[model samples]
Target: MITQKAKYALRALTALADADADEPVMISDIAAQQKIPKKFLEQILLDLKHHGIVVSRRGKQGGYLLLKPAHTITFGEILRIVDGPIAPLPCLSITAYRRCDDCDGEQNCQIRHVFAKVADATRKVLFSTTIADAAQPTHSAEVTRLLA
Candidate 1:
């Protein structure tokens, strides 16, 4: 499951991607536009910066911007930053792979097999999606908010 933190991270990144590349956007602006809580967003932004996905400027007009182009920032990267492993079972995870404590056999674990497929499907969507993709008109807040 995607945590609230991951969702907020994606939301903030999408807002930043919508801005002009030459301009740095204020954190307050992103929070207001995304309706994200300021305190929570600060931490989320900090994590993004630490992961090299975002860079921050400290001054009167300083705020944040993507370290790379929006198209280079994948949803998988954002989710991994905020949500940890993509796979429900650690055994199915690529980076964090470890056998579940209760599971004894790798070849006979039905639950693990099911989750492997789930993880693959999830990875397919998230890895393929980029911050630029999230900024598309079809994904605009006016449309998303209405659907919500």
Candidate 2:
């Protein structure tokens, strides 16, 4: 399951994507527009900023913006930043791979095979799906509806 932090991070990133990429967006404005709690959004955005997923500006006109193009920033990357690994099981994670402690023989384990397939499919979709793809007008309704 996706955490609230990841969801908010994605929402805020989508808002940033919709805005002029060069122009920073006010945190308060993003929180209000995206219906995310300001305090929580602050922490999430800060995490993103630290991860180089987003950049922050300081001053009267300061705000946040994506450091990279939205299309280049995948949901997998964002989720990893906010939610840690993309795979449900550590053994199935490509970036955060770890052997299942319960399994002495993963090569022969049916459950491990199943989780590996699940992880692969999940990663394929997530890695292909970028913030820009999630921000598209065509998909915006579905995404927003899901979030709501």
Runs of candidate 1 with Cα error greater than 4 angstroms are 138-148
- The TM-score, computed over Cα atoms with residue i paired to residue i, of candidate 1 is 0.90
Predicted candidate 2 versus true structure: per-residue lDDT over 32-124, tens digit per residue: 999999999999998898988889999988999999999899888899888888887888877778888888887898888887788887787
- Each prediction's Cα lDDT score? 0.85, 0.87
Best by lDDT: 2
Once fitted onto the true fold, the runs of candidate 2 whose alpha carbons sit more than 4 angstroms away are 138-148
Candidate 1 lDDT at 55 equals 95
Worst 10 residues of 1 by lDDT: 139-148
Residues 1-148 of candidate 1 have per-residue lDDT tens digits of 7899999999999988888776788988999999999999999999899999999988887889889898898889888889887888888888798888898898999887887888887787778777887797765564345324
Error of 1 at 107 (Å): 0.5
Q: Cα RMSD (Å) per model?
A: 3.7, 3.2
